[model samples]
Target: MLGAMSIDLVDLVYRFRKEEKEQHQRIEGVYWVTDLTRCPLKRTYEFKYPELTAKDVFSPVFIMGDLAHRGVESLIKEFFLDAASVEVEGSREVSLPNGRKVIVRGRADAIIDLGDNSKVGVEVKTARADLGIPQQHHIDQVRIYNWLFSLSYSILFYVTPDRVTQFEVRDSVDEEEIIERITSTTYPRYPWECSYCPFSVLCPHKKAHDDRHR
Candidate 1:
């Protein structure tokens, strides 16, 4: 007789997340496209205090979002004839307000070749709610992707519990705007961001929202 085998699901998730992070370790002083979408100070903290800013990669919400992105990428590969690329890496050099130059890099979700030499980028996101289907941060992310990849346009795809939808992002930001976002510490780019930030406890700029004011 054999005893029942038990699987440590938590351990498995942790390993998966660790492997992903290891493969995509951030470079020192290089800003990522995703950074432009979040509180600039958050990035500073992540690099400044690596130990304190370390996150539990095994988080279920984060895992679910990664899984959703993978599923969508698979669907694009299967259905889209012109889906020529996935995880397209791009980088651009921009000078900061202080005249110092830095590299901003990003990996687009996917790229679709129109067969006429034109291509479009894609950015996939998953959320728990459908409200504000096209989030400003997400839009900014895709727009920056377009600029990085030199694509005239890109699609912002969202997967939510209630609905699956996407929006077109044709406008792109200039180098000056990217530099501003990278250097600004205005903090909590979105009102609801602090509530979910892992470093909120250590962040001086964390928004203190009063329920009574709402």
Candidate 2:
């Protein structure tokens, strides 16, 4: 036995870290659908050089968002209990025309089935301020969910301290566009993403406009 030293050493921080690592290992090779849509360049970079893409800075808002996800999940579970609804994450395999297959996955806040094998995908989010309806990036994300789950409709909810704004979107897919974007030699979308990325300094596709490096 290694003795009481090991047993007494465990603390909340250490235990949470240990468990988080174990949970991450479950999806080591797969790309997260959410992350992919946010920044394909970073996604591709991380996929190519996983070791160099370690998270360096932790944002408090990001942490708060993680906690918010749990609260939203619990609330969804309670609301959908008596109704004929499904509130859960879903995953599907999508094959590119260029002969590549990827795992596209996401979770809906709540999916209320309206009969005839139709589902409504729901996405929940917390923001510092409500900026009207869904952003284009968000619209792109839920449409991907529609592609994955064959959802008939989707809704994006942006909640703030004082108000909640929602946007409803229809099902659409553009795999050709996504495939071309991800496989491109340059970063074509969201140059500002690099400014906030931890890998900005090291990324080859990083732009001069990325002020984080300046």
The CA lDDT at 190 in model 2 is: 55
What clash count goes with each model? 0, 0
Tens digits of per-residue lDDT for model 2 on 87-206? Answer: 466776656677778765665667767678877777878877664446667787788778767888888877778777778889577766556544555563655566666667676777
Error of 2 at 105 (Å): 3.1
Stretches of model 1 off by over 4 angstroms after superposition? 1-12, 210-214
Q: Which residue pairs does candidate 1 place in steric collision?
A: none
Report the lDDT of model 2 for residue 105.
63
Q: State the C-alpha lDDT per candidate.
A: 0.81, 0.64
Candidate 1 lDDT, 1-214, residue by residue in tens: 5469887877887888888788877687689998889987778777777665447575678889888878888888888855558878888888776778899999988999876666898888888788867888888988888778888699988888899888999999888788888887677887778877778878777887642321
**How far in Å is the alpha carbon of 183 misplaced in model 1?**
1.8
| Top TM-score prediction, candidate number | 1
Residue-level error in angstroms, candidate 2, position 113:
2.6
Q: Once superposed on the true structure, which residue ranges of model 2 sit more than 4 Å away at CA?
A: 1-22, 25-29, 48-58, 82-87, 185-188, 208-214
- As a whole number from 0 to 100, the lDDT of residue 154 in candidate 1 is 95
Q: At residue 198, give the lDDT of candidate 1.
A: 74
